[model samples]
Target: MKVVNKGLRAVAVLEACKGVVSLLVGFGLHVLAGHNMRQFAENIVSRLHLNPAGHLPSIFIHSASSLTDARMGLLAIGALVYSLIRLVEAYGLWNGLVWTEWFALLSGAIYLPFEIYEMIFHTSLLGVGAFLINIMIVGYMAHSLFSQETTDNQI
Candidate 1:
């Protein structure tokens, strides 16, 4: 039970961190929507000393350059929504709510396909690590849920 509590807290922290990052991204998109996105992206590339013609940098610049204010605003709203959901889930998990285990399991499982696709096609160390971490979290949640169910049934 102590180990289970620790695991739940750990996952809660992870979810909270993700929520904070999404919130920051939402704010950043909102701010950038009113500015010259092309110039902003170029500045980032220059500051990072990245070659503008490089694959990743070029894609970043092109994507930013093509975004309209409306689209950027829409993306900001989407990020905000995602952040809220994650934050709420984190709160519930931190409180050890049974429903949150189900929510976390479902939400984490949803990303498995995308993560697998990333590992197969993109094949980056970061992508692989993310996939592994997500799998572990989902596995833990599943175990927690089923173990509780078995215990209750036995009782």
Candidate 2:
């Protein structure tokens, strides 16, 4: 309710929404595992006008089609945990908590190395955008945290 920065508010809202979507996806994956994945993949490919033999498409189809109940369960549990963390961070940030800002910075920085590695090995526009956005978020939060400390010291 006291988010002073528009950018921070937007990030908080986005994170909350992302968490919700991730939760839904995890549940969907669990439910879909009981269905005929090959048929589902074929339907998706046809709907998207994708070639079945294309490397990325084929890999996706193969991976999805081969998912087991245990794997899907584990994935769902992980997604739920991730979603909860994101939601908590979003709530704290929205309330303008300084500790939440620090948490965001640390979390975002933790992903930088992995993102960089992904860019080096499997570069894509979406990946680049994700990396850049994360960097910006972390930089902005860091700047805000330090600037606030400096201002407080001066007072």
Candidate 3:
């Protein structure tokens, strides 16, 4: 009765990777809130060798400078919470929990509309790839959920 599906394992790994990246980004943002953010932004621009006078670079700097400490804190908290959720989902999926399959399906489905919307308005190779990947994930998880449920009912 135990399931160790390869597709679910792949989804688990992907979720775990997302969680780790989110954690890193959250921690970085949290730390930046307590320091000289302007200096940090400058350091980033310098390391990237971006032209300070360029419009894009100026917009980036302006946006960075405009982020208040409270905003950064909120963003960090949100990221950390999201990371925790993804990690939990990954754990459940890796352990072959049925709830995690439902969770994964719902999560992927929830983003479907947004992805489609973005692709409609801003079509690009990367956007298309992301949309396709999400679609595949959603499709696989949905299939797994329904097939398992049907088999269980038959038994």
Candidate 4:
């Protein structure tokens, strides 16, 4: 079945909206993590040579370090990249660019397997929703991109 321009626009809006939400969420995580890290620093100051190494303190220290570590940076970068991708998709949707449709669909499809695994492992309703949305977007993207190819070849 062929997908229409409206479908493309709707998909673009949906994808871009998700990016905005993700950007906000990533910022929220950074803020929350920063708060926890500040509290950890306070502990180090007050305990000053009192307990060189205690289990709970050590765990907190490690947790704080891990939370602010490289993975967080990677996550931040990923969020930013996805935000740009979403913006590009929005533009592409407005212009009716098939490349954007293919890109969004392919990327969305790539995300689904991981999301599906997360839904099963974490058993979260949110994860399930994300997986389902990705699944739906994949179809629209694929249909639009595919139809474009067929039309182009006829010319």
Candidate 5:
């Protein structure tokens, strides 16, 4: 159906966007690995007018200060791997691959528990939005898979 194809394309675009963001983040981490992260955090807090002594700002600075080059490199590598998976899924979905529907459904569903935990505890608008969007994508993928199976059986 046209509607189903459109939904797949839309989700493919979303997956591609997520991949790009992760890729950018990996590149950023790579670039920042050898830099003065504490000073960078301080600069960010200063530019944002956040009190350096404040709890969140202080934690940010401390966390940044504690980052080792090895740790940063490992995180960058993890982000790169995540980006690659997402991009591949996006490509498969764009091509209407059945395997990609299953992949998307499983991947999206895997985050549901974590998202629900975040919504229950942190309760941020961004967290809620991510949860809703992920759930919708998972549901759509499931529906698409089931419809395909039914069509195949009827044929």
Candidate 6:
């Protein structure tokens, strides 16, 4: 790949690594929470099921629905999808792929504020690093893209 692309690739790899780590940790937590939630819901529903109070059926139905709905499962799946997409964009960034870079630029720019907010509200080492890294990469990529366009216009 070209030197520019090589630099992009480096950035992309870093982003991908970050995404993978976050997704795995999130997934683990989701699973643990899901397990506990299901158990609690089941226990409550079972007791309600045994009681036959007029409202018991409604309670059991609601509790059963809550258990089976598995919002945690949906959250885990969403996180997986987002993580994969981010990694793909990172690959594009690493190789200095124009379209990939643009995608990364727009997406990164959008997320930058959220990251900043997170850092300001809840400071942490990783959050600070992520905020700074995203700002730098997005700025660099935006410049590279615009400059290339300007150069091409003169040609």
lDDT of each: 0.93, 0.86, 0.90, 0.72, 0.94, 0.74
Once superposed on the true structure, which residue ranges of model 1 sit more than 4 Å away at CA? 1-4
lDDT tens readout by residue for model 5, 1-155: 22348899899999999999999999999999999999999999999999999999999999999999999999999999999999999998998887888999999999999999999999999999999999999999999999889988999
Stretches of model 6 off by over 4 angstroms after superposition: 1-4, 26-34, 37-69, 119-124
Task: Indicate the TM-score of model 4.
Answer: 0.64
Give the winner by TM-score: 1 or 4. Answer: 1
The segments of candidate 5 whose C-alpha lies over 4 angstroms from its true place after superposition are: 1-4
Positional deviation of 73 in candidate 1, in angstroms?
0.7
lDDT for 50 in candidate 1 is 100
TM-score each candidate. Answer: 0.94, 0.88, 0.92, 0.64, 0.96, 0.64
Clashes of 6: 3
As a whole number from 0 to 100, the lDDT of residue 110 in candidate 5 is 96
Q: Write one digit per residue (lDDT tens) for candidate 1, span 28-63.
A: 999888899999999999999999999999999999
Global fold similarity of model 6 (TM-score): 0.64
Model 5, C-alpha of 92: deviation from truth (Å): 0.3
Better structure of 3 and 6 per lDDT: 3
Off by over 4 Å in 4: 1-4, 26-65, 69-78
Which residue pairs clash within candidate 5? none
Per-model C-alpha RMSD: 2.0, 2.0, 1.5, 7.3, 1.9, 9.2
Better of 1 and 4 by lDDT: 1
- Best of the candidates, TM-score: 5
Superior by TM-score: candidate 1 or candidate 2: 1
lDDT of 6 by residue, 73-130 (tens): 6767777888888788877776666888788788889988899899989999999988
Q: Give the RMSD in angstroms, all C-alphas superposed, for model 5.
A: 1.9
- In angstroms, the error of model 6 at 115 is 3.2
